[model samples]
Target: MSRFSLVRSAPAPTPAALAAPPPVAPPAARVESKPKSPARDAGLDLRLRLHAKLIEELDLAKLDKLDEAELRRQVLGQVTEFARIERMALNARELEALGASIYDEMVGLGPIEPLLKDDSINDILINGPYQVYIERRGELELTPIRFRDNDHLLRIVNRIVAAVGRRIDESQPMVDARLPDGSRVNAAIPPVAIDGCSVSIRKFSKKPLTLEKLVEFGAMTQSMSDFLYGAVRSRVSTVISGGTGSGKTTLLNALSSAISEGERLITIEDAAELQLQQPHVVRMETRPPNIEGKGEIRQRELVKNALRMRPDRVILGEVRSEEAFDMLQAMNTGHEGSMATIHSNNPREAISRLEQMVAMGGLNIGADAVRHQIAAAVGLVVQVMRLSDGKRKVTHVTEITGMEGQVVQMQDIFVFNRTHTGPDGEVFGEFRATGLRPRCLDEMIRRGIPYDTANFDPSKVLG
Candidate 1:
């Protein structure tokens, strides 16, 4: 018999009980009744019990060998049997929901599984066991879902990292992991995260966003898109700069579609979130140290190793450290179409950040030489930003026109001019091209990559 027992239906009424008369009420008196305490959710408690029973009955050792379909079938069957044995009153819909919840807790990430399955949610932020928040349509809203406690929340985190052959605990209080569908996961616990275990999941779109889709979404104008397509096709090395949640990676992915299929591509990242559609591509991810605090592999090492892989282009997911020096070397060498993303406010700040990163490499090069290297290596700086209204736009399309002494000369080709905010809290901006034509237009024309000089006309509002 199972250890758990449920309240069974009352025994059929006996004949004597049916014959007995109703009891008389006592005389009226001012007897006070205490206020009832708040009741807990009975459904959550039921699901938790069912989850525990399911885990106890299943042969977990052979779970890995079973296909998802078969495992799901077995889980549903077992759940139905368990409910029937316990005499729990559950309808078809309720039974199915119970089965799904049990399955999620058994093989998925527990309480957050439903949130992860919701395509509408862009981000899942867990503040603690009691608080969960999701980002939808660019605004954050709290969800009713929660863990049982801190231990429950930590178990979910452990499951996530373990799937990717990683671990998280007090010794290594933070970790970066990815879901099966390529969503990025970052977790911190205990001493590192003061309140409780916190997890941030950045969900990627099921369908990869292309340049055309971005245009339709008003992320950029048709003219801006055309210019970027031409720039990428002409093998102009570019850098995408943006703040957090600013669609930098999305823009980078869209622009990468412009790359020729014939060229081999190599991508390096901290968590391997890029979804390149090219057949000839190699992806690399950085590794954190093991329990012994050894065997840590950083992005810089991967950047150096990618050089020997014979790539037509090297794509860094994001340059945050000394890898900027090696990335510059790749772009300055034969890898002309290489691209990467950076965290910055604007084009000017992006260049300055790159300079600082190169210096972080502990190289003997002077500041002037570093500026020249940046100017020669990066041809275009695509600045993206998330507006107050939660919409993302390409704020600047800047071209590095080489160096004049210590300064790297850059000119704005396309700019987003924010005029006003709408009554609905929407940001109203027009994407316009400056009157001065970009110097890269000549390079694009030389490469026969289909030029459109009209895109640079000052009178034109591109988007």
Candidate 2:
């Protein structure tokens, strides 16, 4: 038999094999059993032990002074050395992966670093130590990534919040923060989370999407984009309405690009995520109360304060509560190009939600007065929706003309008429112009904003 076949079907040790010298290990190489731990993968123990040893021996201060490339190289070298010293049976590829994981644990968010590095992943959802999910291309899928245990996951959660100067624990229970790249983060732990620690991250694109990019993605037609550009430049107050994860903020950001460079903009959010490209922009974020519950800053307060900042326009990240009242006030009282987003099914529902949120401010004004205020303030309601096929499109671009008594008058300028879903689950639809000329058209003309009147023709079907 051949030597390989002899080894595979060995009945007894060959005399030549028994006489060969044993393989030599590195001088410092040694193997030791790890202390017993619950919920940790058996494969993870060696890497964890090597990581701990590297941490114990590395010069952290010196490493921090090096640039990223050099830092990675030196850290990886140490990781490989420690892996060898611990007698790890890793091939070259496995060693490289181990080194990268250890490097990320040292300088990044540990287990989920790879997911964060993946630009295509739009969201990261951590249900617990053992379950992680990612939303890629608008559809959710489970991933193999996991923490060593619940404590490991909590350490990551705390690391995230602590970097942003926030706290999440039994006392606070929940917190909202943003990554350095402006991705929104929400975390809950322990008593409130029920299933260990849970974290939801809404990641934004590194390069923000513009209106033209949205057009290429079939989000809106060129005519709609033209109308929106004219509307924003002409100082039309607008509200973007959409359901959760339906691209409200994305549309708002794209629309903000239409504003003049000379205009000073102020943005407010629960966790600041808007990427307005204007030079003269001020961003504000709300704060949760301390453990004493005395230092909370709400969006309503920020909205009121933004008015004092002499802003040419106020761009609210969202109008979630009583802040809707203040936002409408800004839109009415000379902050004409101001914009905000709201959660609703359609343009009419968005109007109703605004009226309800205005009441939430505990104002003494009657409902008809509130409706009139909304009608006067918001010039357009751009409704966006994520369809069943995972594609987001502008479903409606309805204009608020005025109030017809207690009812606020509105007209659909552009509407997406869905025909059917294809066999491959793609939504088939056409964006149609209602042909009803918006009142804002006269204002756009008066402002000398160039736009084609034929864009509003009923027969003109847009993409």
Candidate 3:
């Protein structure tokens, strides 16, 4: 500084020079931009573009490789980049949150969630995710709940099958399971499904349908309910018949509610859907095989076991197979008031189906023996049907009048007469009583029970 001052003594160093060179302008408060690398920027752009295209295609097969959280992150990032390029005014944080919520909703919801929520939907059919169908009032209709692809649909199907301890692969391509809500589920995949993966769920009520509810719904007249209650009280073995979705199990449950609370009831079924209110009721269900193909139990096995339980009545959910033989035997041998359901169009067909199922047991019994057992076991057959107008009604109530020759003679004590249909597409029918006067009624009267023949007058009741 002395040398500099000597050299420029003429001007004498200015106060500015002495004052730290005017503070050097404080470096202009520079904002440092993140250094951009051409190679890294290009690589990131390439990755984002590829991921955007993949997401646009909704390719579940490849998306499945990523975990749900990672997929959500990537999707949100791509969406943000897209909005930025389009000069849109979307809040980045809000868009990311929406994407995460949508992903969770689509992934977490089960395939049957929509159908279960729809009150009008009585049944749900999943012929893969792209081919969903539903039944409303006994009619089937297709829906549109498609998956991203076959892989996604299969993933859901596999999840359901695995949860139920069933397998639906190329080898065991078909499976029958039940939902947690007691809905019946059947699934098929790959070679068996043919049309990708398929699933069918027959939804059941979470609550048992009572007799009073059935009467309120006009499924049967109150007189019919009273008579059926009388029949149940009289210990008359009865059978209920109906086609699919005709409320067979619903009717069976209602009838079981009429059973005396003192009686020890034993109920057997393939899937255990019956809801009897009696405290003494014993419920039994069949078991499917494990993955090792061991520990299988059938309805017939349960029925055979129930015989040893000393049941006052054996209630079979539905006699669809050889279990009919054991059920019929139980009913014939002192198990009065025993009841079961069968798939049939009418009373005669119900008898025929029972005989055929009894023969399916692989026994050496002749058709005559089967008929005799059925006639003796089943004293009453009440056939219900879901009409075209979506009303369930008891179409026929027949009393088995014992065996005549090789056939079971049945007398129709009550019949449904279609009066007409109202403008609202409602069916109006009259449940008329036939004055045949069942032979079993006299026995009920003799047991000090009060059942008057005057109640059978159709003119007084069917107005």
Candidate 4:
């Protein structure tokens, strides 16, 4: 029987005839003597088995022909009829939850559907069928969600990849993709993963974060935002450098909002994630090779193609490969206000990394020549990083001041002084200028871009 039997632990001070003890002591009395607790229902296993049978009996042909409303009605009818046949009983809430789970298993990524719908979950990492983890509010926690087995996990992965017109198998075990909502997804299976399929999803926010919002989050100060706005307006070729998950793309999205709506912008990425609200923006993404290993479109080709598209500014999502050379050439060539991001910790490291990437382009140029090109092409490198307490901040606003001797010369006008951490583990620091007047200020003013050098005085600190 699915019904719960409540047995009182203590004798009743006042009793009625209906409460009389059973002719033979009640079966529940043996358990009530031990502890005072509510009775646990024993129908959980039966309900699970019934759910599986219903799913197995589902007719895909009939299901496919119905609209959402019709589908829900049909599924609900089948569930209710099945429960009646099995002599099972469920409360209203339990019935609704089971209906949702069945629908999700048939139509979505089962077990993780709720996580995907949660706006607060920033990341969803599925190690295998038996374990699922999610990142919420910058903290990682294990979840009770799981697939039936490894094969079940693989089925979901295949469904996701197939929707994107891609596939991952033994021959090609790792792939990058995006969900319908534009969340970035990466999957590695079997041999490389060792355990099973490993899937990482970087969730996309529906509302793009703004500079004002970032200030509220203590990501940057008002003065810093003003300086960046002025710099972008001055048509400075800028690059954002940061480690992974350092809010490079989020900051870039915020910065791109400052671009004049009149200008045409072309953005390129392996997976398009930037949400530029400008009306005249064109976005493109690279395509991977087919199963036979042919027909690949790399970012380097896109960079070369963007030159002919008459773009007022080109936004390379990231400069990571031979494309770095093409990106530099674009900046040197008349697309002076172009912007891109690179993976680096500091300005000096970013410059060195760019130089190395230039060589990666197979250009037969010495380091000095590459540094010369960088010095003339790039104007600023803004370094951002995630603090220990899970805060992201613009750490440095550096100016590339031409070549000094054999190296590229750069100076940090503003920097985050990460002096120490507080007792609560919050990063304690202040953003301050390095006391050097930016040479860009003079050029910015000359170009009719309003810039005030007073805000960058070295003696003043900003937080």
Candidate 5:
């Protein structure tokens, strides 16, 4: 048996030590000395006897050896026996209701319950019953909550997997699921996790990130926002790239808000996170297979289908797989100004990562061909980063200048320069213009859009 069983079965404290009462008489005398009323006598005959019997049967040995299904079966059987012996009145529905209450009280709330109620806690990570963590306001911290034990945690894991129509056992032992609120969940048990069962939940926010909020947080200046608005309106295909938890999605959402309302937009994601204000928006999400291991719809498949929908722009939540190829093809065709995000350190590395992803699509194309496609497709790469001082900023806004030989060329149109740092480690950076306006800005001016070169000149504003 496990050590938990030994702890649970430890001897109880003596009555004198537990209370300030006098020494009790012998058990038989104490029982006979009690003043009995009709209600007390009847209640004792049923509930007290049932409680004693249950305590005897629920000893540590029986609990440690039983699987979840067997334990549940035993619990139901005991409930039925107690009801029948007491001649209590209950229908099937009432009995099931009682069973659920007892189960919750005995076993504890399952994995996702605590996470659902916590608005400040953005993420919940479970590394078995003994170790759990949560992310709050971009920082990860450990939590004191635990499952009943490893077996209890496993039972909750199994319920989640089964609800998603997936399976996780020794063979698979890993799965991804989404909660009813659309929070993303990934689980890996035993052998695979190596540190007992593990679960990671990325919480969903019902209210999407907005540009107004970004400005209030000092993530970017209003001039930068105005420039991006012009870029998106002029159909400059942009990619927002950043490291994990670096506000990539938030920036992407803010940028997409600049898209003209007349155009139809289609967004594809593993879990839908984008909040577009336009009325003509269609959202598509990927799906895992059923228990039969069929009917799975992947991101690549959705990307291809989005192409056929005659969309004005295609928005992908994140490009981590071979779907980057189709996304590039769509952009290279007529879908200019289409936007998505990728994981990369800087704008230059974002292009390299896109090229690598295109190669993974099983295409036999040369690197030169891939670079050409990327250059012609992606017009701008906006790199966002969260610095050590807990400030998120747009580190680089780079424009693709086209391909030179086999290499893709990019020019930084806007860059953040750290002007000063105080003794408290707070950074002060200025977003400065590089004097190289995008080639498409001329097109925007020709299309009757007003242009003020003075606003684009950072020196004029700084002075």
Candidate 6:
């Protein structure tokens, strides 16, 4: 090896060897710490421990067999004894509230019962056991309420489905049913729900809102309500279209009240919720399949059967499936004054949905044929929308004239023009006339319904 090789072969002087180790410093002081844990509440613990003791002391199985009155008495007795023994630190008012909450959990929805009893809650949306939201006065608010665990939430969902005599599990994980108070419930669980159970409840008031009441509530103008009153009385085939929860069914119910009480009326719904007050009305609800997957009745079947019942007016709670074709056919074939709701953002989409639904009904026809049928059968399209401010307004009230070329022509007689949103997130707009006269005024005159041409003029916009 060369001297250069010897020089290279020498162990390279290491930086750590050449440089003295940094002077050792004193160790930093150790700070004592504890494992992080969630905050604890004495009230929650007292109630929970009391509930646990009551479960053991009382026979829940026998309690289930007892009637509501006896059950309440037994539960109250158990709570009274448990409170006396535990000597709970809570005051009397707090103790009573705890007892009531326990009772609600036993006989009603547990954490959700309070929300259900809330009159101002329009909707309850549960993402899981921990995330509960409510739609109150048209705005969403996250609530601190939660289920004890995922299993607790699942149990409540199962209970709700069981009460309605429907079943949802891994095999069939979705269900739509109505509560005893007529609130619509939709639920889904895993594997359909990856996280946990999800539920949406759309609440209905016990006393339905009327057209005049809706006007008073700022949902629509008096002039618009007047036009709708005239339209319904004149036997017009109307379709209310909008996004989900946009007040479609509410509008449908209000319009049905305008139908002459003398006419024999029939209503078909997946769930019987139309609270029409007509004396001669017959209500029909569809049924799901049995456990054996038989004995199912669809809305299309009901629509076809309703025609044979010789009804003067047929109201469909909604036309969602192939039933749209039958509903349209009914509208044309002497079923005047018929009404149904469709999901669409605007009037034109409503027309297109009708055609699509016709195709869905196994009609072997061209698009033009379906469009033509929609043009003839459907007369007025009232578009309702839930605005950004949580207020529902009549966004568009359009009239469908005959087809211009291949497309069905629509004229917007009234429209809510939203030009801007306010700084506070409120929608700023006004209902304006589209400067087009409605053709239905001629029908009003022919039918002799109470209406004025001045009310249906082109220039009368309402805010």
How good is model 5 by TM-score? 0.71
RMSD of each: 8.3, 9.9, 18.1, 10.7, 13.6, 18.0
lDDT of 3 by residue, 1-463 (tens): 1132111123333333322211212222323441121222332232333333433445455566877667766566544544455454668676665454345334533445657767677788776545677888767887745554456577767776666566777767777776666677777887776556777777777787788888888788777777777787788999999998899988988888767788999988776667787899998877777667789999999999999998999998888999999988898789988999999999999999988888888999999988888888888999999998877988888999998887789998888888898997888878789877877787677666676566688676542
Q: Write the per-residue lDDT of candidate 1 for residues 1-463, one digit (tens) a residue.
A: 2322321233433335333343435423422451122244566666776676556556677788888877777777767776766676899888888888888988898888988889999999998677789999899999878776577799889999998889998899999999988899999998887667899999999777999999998989999999999999899999999999999989988998899899999999999889887889999999999999999999999999999999999999999999999999999999998999999999999999999999998999999999999999999999999999988899999999999978999999999999999999999989898877888888889988886778788886885
Best by lDDT: 1
lDDT preference between candidates 1 and 3, better one: 1
State which candidate has the highest TM-score: 1
The residue-level lDDT of candidate 2 at 85 comes to 52
TM-score of each model, in listed order: 0.91, 0.89, 0.73, 0.85, 0.71, 0.85
lDDT of 2 by residue, 1-463 (tens): 1122111232433334323343434333223532222354655554555555556556555765778887777767765655555556789898788888887777788889999989999999998777889999888999878877677788888888888778888888889999999999999987887667889999999888999999999999999999998999899999999999999999998998999999999999998899998999999999888888879999999999999999999999999899998898999899998999999999999999998998998989999889988999999999999999889999999999997868998999999999998998988999999989888888899999888888788886775
Cα lDDT tens digits, model 4, 1-463, are 1110111123322223212332423333323223222232233233344445545555555666778877766556655655555455777777767777666666777778889999999999998666789988677899867665566788889888888888899988998888888788899998787666899999888888888898888888888887787778778999999998898988898998778999999999998888887999999889889989998999999999999999999999888888999999999999988999999999999999998898998878988888899999999999999888878889999999998799788999889988898998888888888878877787768867776567777677775
Report the C-alpha lDDT of model 5 over 1-463, residue by residue, as the tens digit. 1122312343433333322332334322223433221222332123324433445546656676877766666656665655765466978776655554444434533544656568888789887666678988667787755654456577777776666566788777788776655667788987787556888877767676677778777788776777777888788899999998788887887888788899999999986667777899999988876656778899999999999999999999999989999999999899998999999999999999999999888999999999999999999999999887667898888989898888899998778888888887788878788787777678678755666666557574321
Better of 1 and 4 by TM-score: 1
Badly placed stretches (over 4 Å) of model 2 are 1-40, 61-64, 89-93
- Global lDDT scores for all candidate models: 0.86, 0.84, 0.73, 0.80, 0.75, 0.80
| Count of backbone collisions in candidate 6 | 0
Higher-ranked by TM-score: 3 or 6: 6
Give me candidate 1's TM-score against the actual structure.
Answer: 0.91
Ranked candidates, highest TM-score first: 1, 2, 4, 6, 3, 5
